[model samples]
Target: MLKFFVVTGIGLALLNGWIIWWLWRALEHTGWLRPMLCLVVAVLGVSFPLLYKLGGDSAIEVWLLRAGSFWLGMLFYVFMLVLIMDIWGLASRLWAEPPVAPRWGGALLVMGLPLVIGCASWFNAANPIVREYDLTISTNDPVPQTYAQSPLILGVLADMHLGRIITAPRLVRAMDLLAPYKPDAVLYIGDIIDDHILVDVEGMAAALARVEPRLGHWVVPGNHEYISGSIKDSLDILRHSGMQVLRDQWRILDNAFVLVGRDDMSRHAFEGTPRKSLPEILADIPHAHRNLPIFVMDHQPSMLDEARTAGAVLELSGHTHFGQLWPFHWVVESMYENPMGLLIKNGLHSVVSPGVGTWGPPMRNTSRAEVLIVKVHFTQTAQ
Candidate 1:
């Protein structure tokens, strides 16, 4: 962890330094403007990490965090735009008969593009859309007649990151969107709370409790839960919200299916304890219930093979944010096998949500915030 912090700090310092240099050049290297630009760059670069480390639950702190997050989003676009302009300038100098000096138009573009995109991204994040999928889980064994008659509507809410940025109202709005679907069960695939310190636990709980699914609300911790440094408190809040917190636990619902929740993989890193393996957890189920359709929720989508090997019919996950911003999803796609949307691998069905809330910047570009409604149908096949 210390190594990670040191490496991240050094990277941020270099990136911010480069931004300062670029801004100075874009502004024609005005002696009077350099200091002001450097000051702004330094402040915005450090605000998020510094304020987060200090940890306060005040409105000022919240707004400061917000400002810092926006800067981070802006920084990405600014850095990219500056780099592109610099490249263009170098190419022009090499190819053209005469190299032209950088103009005010370029500087304005560098400054304005991020603001415009940022506002659009902010609106995209604020208003979440509902994405629906249809899945059929076939079994040879006789199943509950009720499930066979009707498909189960499962609501997926992932990466809410409820805290200063994702307040109660946002959660309320998300719930309102899911109300129409009337999910039989709502699965929260981790990162539900960004940080306990910055969240209004009671308020979040109240917002969540307002909606009651027929089977109930089930949740598995995401990396952020452990990152929050108040796992117990976060779990308590979820319980208060009428959710069944599943940490390396399983429950047989209506004798129709088995729901398994694995602790976030980060537990080993943060708490020095590893979560139970997928097969190990499944072994605990009595033989009588083994043939029942299995649903697994592992926050990162890192264990799809394990779930598939364990005969799980469906696995739901969130945490990728599908890059949350453009071009970044490219990186996310390379990291996870099923980064976003649906994947049917050999038999195991996986749905990876881009998440319902933003993490740092409260902005989304690659994909809009979404709630997944998967209609799962149970069908019997001949032995």
Candidate 2:
């Protein structure tokens, strides 16, 4: 953990230094103006991390966190824009006539573009839309008559990093959007709360318990839960919110299907406690219930093959946030098999949500914040 922080700090310093150097050269301003501009950039670059370390639940802290987070988002765009400008300038010098790029205009383009897009992205992140998917799985064994008659309408809420930035109102709004679907059960695929220190546990709990699904709410801890530095507290608050935390555990729902929740892979790294393997967890199912279709809720989508190999029919996950921001999605996509959206490998159905809340910066450009509604149908295979 210390190593991670040290590496991150170093990276931030170098990146900020590069940005400052570019701004200094590009601005071509005198005295205080250039220095002030660089100072502002450097401060904004480190603000979020610095404020995060000096943890407090005060209003001032919360506002600073928000401002710092927004700046972080803007900073990404600024960095990219500046890099592009540098490349363009180099290419112009090498081949074409050096295009007369105005200093102020260049400055405006770097700052203005991110500002315009960041504001729009903020609005986009705030308002989450409901996306629906229909899935049919074939079962060799006969499904219960009730299950066949009524498809399972599972509502998925993932990555609601409810802390300083994502307050109760955002959670309330997300729940309100899911109300119409009337999910049989709501599955929180982790990162439900960002940090226990900054989170309003009672308020978030109250808002979460507002709508009661027929089968109730089930949750698995994402990396953020462990990252929050109070995993127990986060779990307690989630339980208070009427959510059942399944840490490498399984529950038979209505005696119709198996619901397995795996602890996030980060558990081993963060807590030094490794969760049960998919097959190990599945082995705990009673012989009578073995044939039942297995549905899984894993915070990270890293274990799809394990779930599939363990005979799970459907696996729901969130943690990717679909890269959350633009171009970063490309990076995220490179890491995971199915970074975002749905993927079916052999018989396993995996739905990875982009999530309903922002992690940092509270802005999204590549993907929209979404609540997934999966209507799962069970069809019996021929004898």
Maximum-lDDT candidate: 2
lDDT per model vs. reference: 0.86, 0.87
- How do the residues 90-124 of candidate 1 rate in per-residue lDDT, one tens digit apiece? 88889974665556677779879998999999999
Across 1-383, the per-residue lDDT of candidate 2 in tens digits comes to 88998998898778778889887886785667888988888777777888777676688777777888998888778888888888888888788786645376788788899999999999999999999999998876787786778888899999999888788788888888988888899999999988776566667767666777888899999999888877888788888877998998999998778999999998889778898899888887899888888999999999888888888989999999888888799999999999998899989999999999989889998899999999988888788
lDDT of 2: 0.87
TM-score of 1: 0.94
Which pairs of residues collide in candidate 2?
none
Off by over 4 Å in 1: 28-38, 91-101
What CA RMSD would you report for each candidate? 2.0, 2.2
